[model samples]
Target chain A: MKRGWIIGGAAVIVAVFAWLLFGGLQKNVVFFLTPKELLAKGTDGVGVPVRLGGQVKPGSVKWNAQTLDLRFIVTDGAREVPVHSTGAPPQMFRDGMGVVVEGRFGTAGVFEATGLMVKHSNEYRPPKPGEEAHEKYKTLIQQSSQ
Target chain B: MKPEGQLNSSSDRLRDPSAARPPRTSIWLAFVSIGAVIVAQTYAILTSPAEGDMGHLQKIMYVHVPAAWMTFLSFFVVFAFSVRYLWQRRENDDLLAASAAEVGATFNGLTLMLGMIWGRPAWGVWWVWDARLTSTLVLFLIFVGYLALRAFTDDTQQKARWSAAVGAIGALNVPIVYMSVKWWRTLHQPPSSPATLDPRYTMGLRLNAIALLLVMIYFIRKRYEIARLERATEHMAEAAAMGGK
Candidate 1:
């Protein structure tokens, strides 16, 4: 009887913890905002960390080898926001490709990117479940669950 | 204490109730406490002042920090009880360790998810091999492996012993995971502990952290109780059948 109580008590604890951690509906739940949403929400120094999702404008990319500064324009097909970044760019960051940049709008309303992430168009399979970088997570699960 | 072979019977009956009566109100109190914490956390995340730089994404901090706290805290519980279980061979201790390990895994997984979401914009990459991030990845995987081992083993006593060992050893990585940022040249930022944040934000975050901690404890307790109940039900059924025989 005592043992049974212990087990039941433990289960309740886990469930309660999950609820407390994630059950709340925080308005800050981050979502992928479309290009239209980004444009509609004009960037007037709001400093909202936005995942500006759009295609890199074809003719707008200019790279300065000396400074390693990459200048590009992100377009929502209707409006374009100039992006200035100083960092090693990801491989997938290409012209006319979909990308998300994290940063706030500059004083001139350009989307000055502090971080850049590339998105893949291809869907992933199960044994691979898609992410090439998820191997570390899989390995951890394997060792601990063993 | 007992030989390896003799562990089977003891393991099989690990859930047998030693309690004359279950403390039912404790479970309800746990639920109410968790609910209250959720409310407080939600308010903080939604109504908190936007940052001068990150704006709304700054709010992600509320969720990110608590999830991180739960992940580490749950693992700590697992480590403590696991040691006790191994040293004293107490059934309750073993169960507590297992329960905490499972909960810890869940919270750790959530932390990773929230981190990824927060990272997409903040780091410009969905994933990175930074020291802190990589170590956390390992921690989560270890927990998953621990749970898997529990599922794989059929013999109760053997399963408990094996898992207890895993829980104890696996916890060694928690501190390593936390310190990975300091130890390695990584992109991830180190934490600003309670003493670091600006007063107002610090107070709010600390309050939320405490609320989340309580919530975590309640969940661990409830989970432990449910497992106990299930075990009791099984034992009762077994005993009734034996009487019929």
Candidate 2:
């Protein structure tokens, strides 16, 4: 009888855990897509949690440090998506860098990024010689550096 | 040293070969494993490239990722032993399960602490409710409870049986923890290995993982030996009491 109680209790606990895990997963899993893929999806991609990965467009970065409002464009060679982000951008965030932004696409054709992650790798090199990214965001980078 | 608790007869004392020879090899292995880990870590840190984003902070990955992997590996050992003990009811299997749980818990704590240090700058938060991090924390807590349960029980058989149950159930979380990043939205980046990391970084991670794994096995083996000797001593004590009665 005692053994039965223990087995029954464990079964219930496992069941509860499985329920919580499967239920929570529905709301939490974020879809990953590129700018081109997202645009191709039309209305299906808007108002849904998504992670957009691409290279930041050169000369499109606009940052107001005081307000912590930042704007940039993410592109996939052929297509571009305008992104508006809030709060202080990560210190290493810069133009022409690979980044994954987590948020949703607004119907207005802008990516509303709630979180920004600069993809860091040991292989990352500085912008190539004459790359305008270094010159384009120099002021914003300088302010953040200080 | 002569066996302390006198058993019913000289036959019992003579039967224990473990009481005759000290564990010199295990002791030497412990020393060698510790040294190997130290040397490997030095090589890993010195050979790694400075990351452009996290910069020098990326060096923490050598220790952090290996520690996390070892933690999961140790728990897997516990799960295996726990299931075996349940099916066979062997005391040695229970001891092995208990030993692995202790080492797994220590490595789990190390993983969590190091992850927080890496997260502070990378994610801009020391702790987050992201699925990957949260599930790992739950796994740690479950093992902790397993340890506590083992400590509070006085009956050896009861302790072994109960702990084996907890160990098996707790290990169910291990797969969930590993898949959490891919299955759900997480702040933590996906694994960087084999493909994601450059060859330069991959070398360091591989070396460090070997070192951590070696140390984990050595520690678990030493702990298992101690558990075995302890059980032998208890058996002698219980026999002595019975003889007196």
Candidate 3:
């Protein structure tokens, strides 16, 4: 009888613990905020350390070699945020690529990113026949080396 | 003093029959699995075309993914044996659980290291406290705690009972770790499957997983044998001490 009680007690404890954990996680587990979510925050989202995740808006990428200034628009379908970061973006970074940039939104409206990371999809494929991989990035790589 | 002399004689008597006969299957498995791993890795590297973006760095998946899968597999073994030990009150089950925990911990460590090596170039950082990574680290620590509890305890029955509980509870984290990416907005990608992966890379991934599975089996079997021998020796020593008294 006592053994049964002990087992039952353990089960109850584990259940309660799991409930608390998952319940708490539901509210607090936003690892990065989408641009739409961040835009909804309005002033509250500005001037705070945050990770903003979205795709680099196509045709919105601007890079300055002399200043190492990278400017891009990150859009999550409904909303977009302009991002400005110093230093080289990852090798895989390109227009229309998914990305997460870490920093705060400046009062001037641009996200002043201190760190930039590219997010790749799970797909893996070699360059198609008669096509070259890394062709577009060859100049970027050489410029970075220089 | 008298018990010491009796202990040696008792252990010798117990060991003679088994010691003379080597574990031939385990030895053969060790060689076969090691060879298979080498062949699988070589084939994976040479045949799989370079990924479009990451190039050859994607080949690390052959090792990293298999190690992670084996880690989960080993922990599942520990969980099964632990529950069996609790139900049956069998000493062999306890020993088997411990052996699996040891092997699981090794694979867990490998998974973390290989993930870091992949992450540095791919994620631009060595570590991240994202949901998936943190949960995996937590899983590794839980088993480490389980192993430590076994080591610190002196009473065999108490040690087995305590570790069984720990092993069972720790294993509950495996699913959470596996689902963390899906459950949270994390930088880590969702779980990879045949459907998710391109067809070209599927064969290499499957081959590596099979090879590593063989290696994991060999490790668990060899470790279980050692654990059983250690327990047998302990039993002989205790029985000899009682006889001397």
Candidate 4:
């Protein structure tokens, strides 16, 4: 009888553990999507938290330092999603750089990124083949020197 | 002290519980394990290749991944020995479980610190509430609680019973921690250089894993010896007190 209780109790605890793990994961997980897939979701993807990953489209970035308005278009191979942020981008943020932005898609077809992260590896250099030169950002960089 | 195989002859202590002196080879094993770890660390740091984005900072992977591996190993030992103790009612098994939990906590701490160091550079943040990081922290806390629970209990049998249950239950978190990155949309990067998946950091990582395993085993064995000695001393003291009366 004692051994039966022990076994029964363990089963109950394990059941509870399994339930909580799956339940919590379902609620907390944010979907990771590229611009094209996100767009395909239409209204379902709008206003939902997500991690949008893509490269910064070359020559599409615009910044006004005084206003702290940073604008850029993020692209996955074929499609582009315009992204708008209000703060100074990260130090390594540059055109054609891979980035993962966390936020929601606005109804206006813009990705209103709340958290902008520049994807970088330790030895990744700023200059790579086919990337626009960093010198292009000189004017806006000086305007919004941060 | 016994003969040639005395140092880590676990069965020797089981046969003669009062034997306080560990054989010579066991002591030498500890020294040799430490030396090998240092050499392994140096080789890993020197030979690490700079990842395109992470640069030399990627070298931290060697220590970070191995520390994580040891954490899993230590907890698994605790789980295994805990089960054996409960089933067989053996004090030796309980002691082994306690020793493993302690060693595992040390490695858990190492993994957390190394992750933080790497995170600041790679993830662009010091910490996050992502499933992977949070679950690992929970795993550390669970074992730490297991140790604390052992310390507070007074009776040997009671302590063993309670710790065994706690250790086993706490272990449920290990698999959760490992899978959290995959199951959840985590900020933490997914496994890049697992043994077969990618050969990028395999050499340094595997060598360091071997070296860390040696160090962990040495620590647990030496700790078990101390536990045995303490138990023996307690028994003798009890006998002396009763005889005096």
Best by lDDT: 3
Candidate DockQ values, in order, are 0.04, 0.22, 0.57, 0.26
Query: How do the candidates rank by lDDT, highest first?
Result: 3, 2, 4, 1
Cα lDDT of model 4 by residue, A1-146, tens digit: 74576568678879887886777656656435788889998899999997787889998988878898889999988788999988767554778877778899999999999988765422222234565434433455677765
Residue B82 displacement (Å), model 3: 0.6
Higher-lDDT candidate of 1 and 4: 4
Tens-digit lDDT track of model 2 for A69-95: 899999989899999999776655777
**Best TM-score goes to which candidate?**
3
List the global CA lDDT of all models: 0.67, 0.79, 0.85, 0.77
Top DockQ model: 3
- B1-245 in candidate 2: lDDT tens per residue? 54445453543653768653325335677777788788877887787656645556677888888998988999999999998887789888999899999999999999999989887766455776667789999999999999999999989989988999899989989988988877775666767656656566777778888888889989888888888778777776776666655
Error of 1 at B126 (Å): 0.8
* Residue B245 in candidate 4, Cα distance off native in Å: 1.8
DockQ, Cα level, model 3 = 0.57
Clashing pairs in 3: none
Worst 10 residues of 4 chain B by lDDT: B1-10
| Candidate 3 lDDT by residue in tens digits, B99-185 | 999999999999999999888777677787888899999999999999999999999999998898889878888888888888888
